[model samples]
Target: MGKIVVSENVSLDGVGQDPTGEEGLRFGGWFGQVGDSDREEWAKVGFAEALGAEALLLGRRSHEWFAARWPSRTGEWADRLNGMPKYVVSSTLADPGWNNSTVLRDDVVSEVRKLKRRVNGKIVVYASGRLVRTLLAHDLVDELRLMIYPFVLGAGDRLFDGIGDRKPLRLVGSRTVGDSLALLTYQPIRDAGA
Candidate 1:
């Protein structure tokens, strides 16, 4: 069975929106707030994670976003991402333009469950906040990896904004990356009575 890992870059206040400032949201570009060394370390962490993932799962918007940027980039990370099997969950997307990309147009829950059974290794998800919430609500996510930046974006969309219940998680790993980033890994505690 595959492990559904939801990886995200978030602010100190848990805001995960507009990290690249492309959305034009207020406080959008928190991703570049740190120094060059810190950014380099963060990139290294992401590269390592990408190296370990067997496939990528994303929502439509995230798929479009990544497809637009990663296809033209040249590097080990970009190459890996561009070449990996990508599944995008969307009701409207007819064609996924990125390389090795597939559009999952069925019921999101059912499609993801099928995907989990089909994949043997890690299916990593990135920058798909809505899909992450759905996965969490349905108890589909196996691991949550968060790279927390130092800034506090007080007014942006947060990671856990619409989760219906208090899902408990057990901390599996944690480390400080670069000067100001906190790399935290968590596994969802599936038992209700724990």
Candidate 2:
């Protein structure tokens, strides 16, 4: 079975929305405020995660967002992202334009469960907030890694919002990436006797 790893760049206040500013969100583009050195170092962290993953699982919006940008870029990170097998979770996506892509349009829980059984290594979800919440609700994610930035966006949509149940996390690892971000790795601690 494959492990579902959720990797995201989030602010100190837990805001995870529109870091890139492409979505026209109110707090969008906050991610770019960091210095070049910080950004450069964070890229290494992101690249390492991509290199370690066997595939990518994304929400429709995220899939579309990535499809629009990564294909035009050229680099080791872009190469890995563009080449990996991608699973896009959407009910309306008739065709996934990216190569090696599959669309999961119904019963995400069941389809993703099957996908995990078939995959060989890590299946990662990157900054797909809606998808991440769904995975967490269903107890689908095996690992959660957050690169927490120093600044806080008080009003933006958060990464862990709308979770109906409280899930405890087991901290596995942590480190400071560059000057402003903290990389934290966790695993959901299943309920007792569950």
TM-score of each: 0.98, 0.96
| Global local distance difference test of model 2 | 0.92
lDDT of 2 by residue, 47-70 (tens): 998999999999999999899899
After superposition, candidate 2 runs with Cα above 4 Å error: none
Best by lDDT: 1
TM-score of 1: 0.98
Backbone clash count for every predicted candidate, in the order shown: 0, 0
Clash pairs, candidate 2, are: none
